[model samples]
Target: MTVHFHEASQSVTTADAAYAGLDERHAVQSGPGTFKVYRALGKRIFDIVCVLMALPAVLPVVLIMMILVATDGGNPFYSQMRVGRHGKSYRMWKLRSMVQDADAKLKDYLESNPEAKREWDHSQKLKRDPRITRVGRFLRKCSLDELPQLWNVLRGDMSLVGPRPMMIEQRDLYPGRDYYALRPGITGLWQVSSRNESSFADRARYDALYNRELSFFTDLRLIVATVGVVCRATGH
Candidate 1:
């Protein structure tokens, strides 16, 4: 699972390489496997091409979802800061899939329901969340809530395939700064692999793995798998 880091400036010196390869006891904790330099340019090109190709279909759906979200008497779009590559922050966009004042509602609901509170504490999610509108819930089930991120992809704030961005509070959970090396994605290894069913720690591992194994074939496979996940309405 170890892919050596490339790039001359970030290169591993002989001494450091030896130290990293030493017995597990003496090994340096260098996050996950190294980044694949060769994939860098190709990945961006692929993201652009794919997003452009999907725009015709995606735009219409986004417009319809906007109307549906607005019918609930709230803003149809949501934007929140998410940690991006190199620990920089960016506004990640989404179609609103929750009621107005969702945070406040979540607080009130959690205070009243111990079971829901526990679920939130464990996974930061609730299988039956009370904050989501009916339309929002359906959008979320189909992962349509994330369609607005096509703009993020287009703007270079995200990739078509990479680790999903984490909240600022989840910063420490990263294996190291390695998670910050790649732009986050709307769908990724974690989403297609287990979605909310996997624990936070497991998701982190998957994120690291995806960062390591990125390539044309890898991205293609994940994208194809993501379609199946969406068609099955298994996303959240």
Candidate 2:
């Protein structure tokens, strides 16, 4: 799939109009024709098999991170409501990568920092976020914080490759229809590509492109690319 990168100034309305001609029915199905067995069944099977094989290596790291994160006297795991296929919501889990009162800190910090607030509004992330702890920074860089999402993949609330899960509150901010038609992914086009560099709105374009070009080989390629991203520690 050729992912188009738009200027960061692009508005939600503009992004939506860009894909206004996309067929919603076709977006839900993998590629063109009906009876695409992979989208219906094989994709889920792939998620399960990959997760099962990965758990052997992933579980130990998760366990270790849990203890390390909890050493600060807070819950080691964090979960938040995320929009899933068909606009359904589910609790997406992750290893805690922030302080116990991250929300409160963020609210107060943003109010005092106009520049930071602008960044958050545009990308929904903070490069120099004060909420991240010392160990948390390392985990975020290595992307170990996202390993817990392997459970979400097994639960069928997510895919190994698809659009990144949008926050429940971001439902209004998102302008593309493709994300609602498919399960969210732990790593996808945006995540493996622009990631932290792009505005949150750019996700719509990547999600739509991914859906329009959905295929077994596409998922496989994205999964392999994810491994390289993780090895390079490109997160955060």
Candidate 3:
């Protein structure tokens, strides 16, 4: 399957020519193609417009997060590089939920506990991580930590819905080259469907499936389901 990265939206605007499909090394000429075109020219236009439309509702939440972080004595926004379509890297931004030196603490924790290192080998999260601050834990559980990602969507680095983007290290940890075909999304099938409970292999399967069948309606379904999951606090 050819993994394609799109402007994390419904816009046709581009810094690069719309990428044609992959080179022949990964071509599949004889199969019934199930992939729908969710990440496409017009889809991005939809995304940009959606973000603008949603700003009225989204602003209050963003302001709330900013207030908490600012009062809590930490940076309000966090940015990290993540792999996007075709393995290209982009800065994925989010609201900060950890202490300022969360990354440094992760390095220390990994070195101190062999068991944690074992989990980190395949899955990047610790089961009971100590680095997440109080507000961070609440934000993550409530899905509020991701509010800043809307800006990422507006910037075209990611989409509002699709496969979830992984940190740079996580991108390298994934096992397959074909997985890069889809752009990393803020909320995707894996996220609303299983999220924190899912294993790496399960996540890879869901993302691949979405890539094989990308479409506007399909994405809309995912987005609606994502809202349900978040509102119900059913998935992390």
RMSD of candidates 1 onward, in order? 9.9, 5.6, 9.8
What is the C-alpha RMSD, rounded to one decimal, of candidate 3?
Answer: 9.8
* Candidate 1 C-alpha lDDT tens digits along 1-236: 01112112222132133224233432242222222433657778888999999999999999999999999997899999999988889999999988889999999999999998888776677989888899998898788999899899999999987776788877765555556788988777666555554556666666666665565666766687678667777555
TM-scores, one per candidate: 0.81, 0.85, 0.79
Is candidate 1 or 3 superior in TM-score? 1
For model 2, where is the 10-residue window of minimal lDDT? Answer: 1-10
Candidate 2: list runs displaced more than 4 Å.
1-35
Looking at model 3, residue 178 earns an lDDT score of 42
- Alpha carbon lDDT at 43, candidate 1: 79
Tens-digit per-residue lDDT, 175-202, candidate 2: 7788988999887777655666566557
Candidate 1 TM-score over all chains jointly: 0.81
Give the winner by lDDT.
Answer: 2
Where does candidate 1 stray beyond 4 Å?
Answer: 1-38
Candidate 3: worst-modelled 10 consecutive residues by lDDT: 10-19
